[model samples]
Target: MALWSGRFEQGVSEGAQRFGASLPVDRAMYAQDIAGSIAHARMLGRQGILDAADVERIEKGLLNIKRQMDEGTFVWDLNDEDIHMAVESQLIRDVGAAGARLHTGRSRNDQVATDTRLYAKELLLSLVDGNDALRKVILTSARTNFGVIMPGYTHLQHAQPVLFSHHLLAYFWMLTRDHVRLVAAWRSADANPLGSAALAGTTYPLDRAYTTELLGFSHPIPNSMDAVSDRDYLLDLLYACSVSMMHLSRLCEEIITWSTTEFGFITLSDAYSTGSSIMPQKKNPDFAELTRGKTGRVYGDLMGLLTTLKSLPLAYDKDLQECKEGAIDAAGTLQDAMACVGGMVATWQVNADAMRAQASRGFTAATDVADYLARRGLPFRDAHEVVGELVLYCERRRKGLEDLTLKELRSFSPLFDDDVLEGLDPEGIARARTTYGGTGHEAVKTQLREAARQLGRDRRQASSLRGRMPNVTGD
Candidate 1:
């Protein structure tokens, strides 16, 4: 029977008990739950609400349970509605009345909130590490292939010549913004709510600050009602996971497209690919495709939780039980997706020759040719018109802009001198855009250095945050 069954005329039906249980889902947070209970027990002893002897016994028993959990020998009770009931009931059986005192000043409302916040800190840091590891792989890939040239696209059409390093740096910046979101989620979950005791503050003179110190929370939450009901931190975490997965999916889509026979820009490693059962000559990027497909699932996790928490009443409710599973799923999904993509990109071979060959075929130098005319005294609009006509002329005769002789170029505009050919080639065109954030070789190198600096800083921040997370130690 439940601890609250004392006043009930009859116990709940077995089906209702099974239906309302959150233990199976929340038991994943056993360590957090145990740690929160121990801290609460110590606070009770300090406040003179319980005998030190009782507190000592509670601590020892909880530690033993934790040890059992660590060793994979903890027996789970299917009849218990949640982990709190299971632990409290077993503690009473083992330590008698002293164990029953563990719940004297607190409610399950504040207890579960504490557990979820601690676990969120852990999940957020893990994703930071995941984000960092993948960023490192991307940065290294950029530095190693700094000299490769590719066509930059707009509307899926080649619009400019760009260094390959610049192209990959775009994803690096996307992940950098993800770190910002993670920091927000971490802050939101860093508060202590264990002393709220249901919807109203308890009358036990509980020192919430002491418990906050013991549990390593940033501060005690100010409002009891919000403390029990607030799940914005979990929402923030799910949002981070969703956005990061979207970024990874975008990268995976490109990997899928680039590995195709028509693009041939990359060759995925055999370990990251698979052979078709029916097609004798197929090497498919199945992992990348799966990463792309799994993005929608993470999106669903975020949206599901958003709807679950929509305008629910003040204080905790059964609807809150629906929150944990989706956040847990999204975190694990994103971590695995990062691992798979990091390995995929790290091992896949870059086909520089194919990339460079395709870069020159799309009239990619037309803008540069027009820029040449603009610099030679033609008005800017006239220069654009002149390049448009030149492109049509080349299309008719099946010749590239580079194929035009100085005499043929001067026929359209005497401003087209012999030196106009200097920047007309692939490498020259890519290297000519010397502006910051451009595709020039030097510009990309600048981006690489800044990316390296920011990656180091984010890793250090993640490490500092991880180190300060809650621990079972009395300190």
Candidate 2:
């Protein structure tokens, strides 16, 4: 029988029971639900709302149920509707009236809010760890491939020569922002909502701060109605996931482009690539392609939750049941995607020769040449125009600037000399950029050090959070 069936004239229709059931979706949160119940039971005993004996029995029953669940021995009933009632019904059966007393001062509304918050906290920590792992891989790649020159693009055209490490560090910083967003989402989910029974403050003398401490929440939620109704934290988490996935998609897109025959800048490991079913010569970057494609699905998860929460009125409503699936999907998707991307990056082979060859083409040194002329007393705009004419001349001759003789370069401007040839060397051009955050060797080394420091700080932050979380299972 359903837990709320006592007030009904008849059992709900089989179809309604199936339609309203959240067991399948929320069963994943069973551990969190059980942990919340244990904390609430202990709090009730301390406040004298339930006697010590009943509290002891309730606690024992819940622990036993959790053990059953952990060991895959618990039976699930479809009529239970959701994980909360499923556990509660079993608790009552095991411990009789004491288990019934567990619900005296709380409602399913606040119970669910608490459970979801705890679950979100756990998932966010996992995300933080996953992001940290990805960052470490990026740092490793940057350190290993430092000073390897590649053509940096703007609008998908070669615009300058940059170290490959500088390019990888750019994504490292993107993920650094993503880590910030994940931490923000964690903060949003850290408040306790357990004392806000139904849509209003509870009548009992409930000690909310006690439960907050027991559950490792930073503080009790300030508003009752908002406590049960608010899903902004979930939205925050989904947004973080969506944005991180989008970043990964951009990285994967580059991986795809760089692995192609035309670019030939990298080769994905065989474990991360696949052969065509019929084409003997095909080796495809299927993992990177799939990661790129999954970006849209994560975006859909964010939009789906936003649309679900768009028009709902305050306080708990059945509409809120639509929230969990999207969040669960997004969290799992992001973790998997990050793991895939990190592995791909860690295992891929960098084609330094091909990168340097490509970096040398496309007049990548035009800016350096122009700077050379400007440094030699030519006005900057005039130097630019001269380089433009020189590039045009080279294009017409089907030759690169390196192929031009000092005499040919001097024809454009008397500023051209033998030293101008130094600016045409791809490696030299890359190293000439010494501005802070530039792609020069020294600038990239600075970035690598800063990235290492940031990664260590984030890992420490994650460790601190993990330390503060309550032990759900008594080992």
Candidate 3:
């Protein structure tokens, strides 16, 4: 029988019961459900709807249920539809009639809404923490590899030589935006929805603000119907997760490519890699590839929730039950992916020599050389054309620009001098980029300092949130 079965004359079939139950998906919200119930009970007592003794009895029963669930002693009967009903039914059995008073001013509509908000808030905070850890790893890697030059590419062909630190910092900024998205998602959930009973306001004199304060929400939701029906917090969270996963997948694609024998740019540590089953010599980057592959799963979760919410009308609906599994799946998949990537990055080895070797080939210095010719009184367009001829001559002779002698360069343009050789070297080309935010070593140092400042601010924000939750520590 269901918890609301008093109105029905017969029980639902066992198969129907199993098919309709949300216990498997909602069980993860048990802690949130208990926390919301406790706040609701205290609000009822404060408003004189429930006696102080009943409040104490309800709190005690909820805590005991939490303990049994924590200790693996609680029986999770399939007859219970979800974690909310399961715990409430247990509370009634334990505390007799006072347990019934726990729901005096609320309905499961707003109650489950409140619980989901709490769950989303906590998950958002966890995601912020993960983003911080990843930011730190990227900033550290960038700082350590600041001077290591790599071929900056367009269309997978060398376009210029860029400092490796600059490349790494680009990803750091992408993740910083992810941290911002998590903050927005967290705020979306920072409101109490407890007093919106079913689709309308409750008749009892419940203080929604008091419950909001007890639950650490910013305020009580203003509209009764909107409060019960809103799953925007979940939508915001899933969207954030989806975008973050996309960014991570892009980084993972780079990792997979950079680690391959073809690129020879990085090596994964054993802790973050797996060996082939039959190959005698193989160290496969399974973790990075998995992060890349799981990105579509997060995308699917986002689309599934959007489809579920698109046509639904008004206040709570059974269709809303379809929302939980996708949000939970997206969050879980993203968290695991972030962890795997963070660990892989923290332990992996950067192949500086290989990166530097690729930096010099494919005319990475052609741009600097053109600029040098243009500076020496050649019209910029004309300088480009003349350098193009020099490159063509070198290609015909199976020679690089660096391989050409001072006399050979003079054949293309009379501007060539013994000093021109100084501008042609890869190291000099990288250093010649003195513009702000260029690939020069000094510019990379400036970028690193700015990155550190941003990372410090994010850490302080995360730490302040940690101070709010004494029960949670170190992710």
Candidate 4:
């Protein structure tokens, strides 16, 4: 029988029962559900809503259920509909009338909301660790290949020479912003919804603050109506995952391009690469390609939930049941993508000579030429024109800026001197950008140190959040 079936004359059809069940999606949150119940039961006892003996019985029964779940001995019944009912029904069976007292002042509306929030908090902490791991891998790569020069592009055309470390650090900063988003999501999920039973204030003298402390929530949600219905925290989480996945996709796109024969800038480790069955010579960056492809699915997860929540009336509804799976799916997708990207980055071999060779080929020194002329008394526009004509001349002659003689360069501008040749050197061009946050080697060294500091701070913050969480075994 369904938990709410006593008031109805007939049982729900098997089809409807299966259709309405959230068991498949929410079973992963059973630990959180149990934790929330234990906290609520203790709060009830403290407020004298339930006696201490009943609270004790409820606590022991909940722990036994958690143990059965951990040991794979808890059998789920589709009739239970959701994780809350499954756990509650088992609690009732184990502790008799004491379990019946557990729901005296609460409703499934607030209970589900509380459980989801707890689960989201736990997942966000894991995500923080995952982001830290990926950031460390990026910092390690930047440090290992600090002075390697690569062509920096705008619209896929080489625009300047930049240190490879500088390029990788750009993603480090992107993910640092992502870490902020994750923390924001965590804060949004930190409020306790347990006392706002069924979208309204409960009749019982519930000690919401007690439950908040017991469950490690920062505070109780101030608005009872909003507590059971609000899913902005879930949206915050999905948005964070979407943005992080997008960043990963961008990096993966570059990895795919760099590993190709035409670019030849990198070679993914054999462990991260796949071989062609028919073409013995082909080594494929399939993992990078897959991560890039998975970005669309993460985007879909966000959109699906947004559409579900768009027009729903306030308070709990059947429609809200659609929210959990998307958030869970997106979280899982990002976690796997982060791990894959970190592994790929950690193991890839940088082809320094090939990178430098390509960096030199595409007139990457044109900007430096323009800068050279600009520094030597010509207006910046005039300097740009001179470099444009020089690039055209080199293109027509099948040559590079470095291939030009001093006399040949002087043909374009009297400003040309033997020193212009030094400016044309790709490494010299890269190291010349000494402005803060520039691609210069010294600037990248500073960036690497700051990145290390930021990563350390984020790891410490995540550790602190983990410490605050109520220690549930096997969570």
Candidate 4, 20-118: lDDT as tens digits: 989999999999999988889888899898999999999889999999999999888777889989999989998999998999899999999999999
TM-score of each: 0.97, 0.98, 0.96, 0.98
Error of 3 at 456 (Å): 1.4
Residue pairs with colliding backbones in model 4 are none
**Can you tell me which runs of candidate 1 are displaced by over 4 Å?**
473-475
Q: Regarding TM-score, does 2 or 3 come out ahead? A: 2
lDDT of 2 by residue, 357-393 (tens): 8888899999988899889999999999999999999
Off by over 4 Å in 4: 472-475
Which of candidates 2 and 4 reaches a greater lDDT?
2
Pairs with backbone N, CA or C atoms under 3 Å apart (clashes), candidate 3: none
What value of lDDT does candidate 4 attain over all alpha carbons? 0.92
lDDT of each: 0.91, 0.92, 0.86, 0.92
Per-residue lDDT of candidate 3, residues 70-139 (tens digit): 8889998878988889999999999999997787877899988988988888888888988989889888
Which 10 consecutive positions of candidate 1 have the poorest summed lDDT?
Answer: 466-475
Best-to-worst order by lDDT is 2, 4, 1, 3
Error of 4 at 455 (Å): 0.7
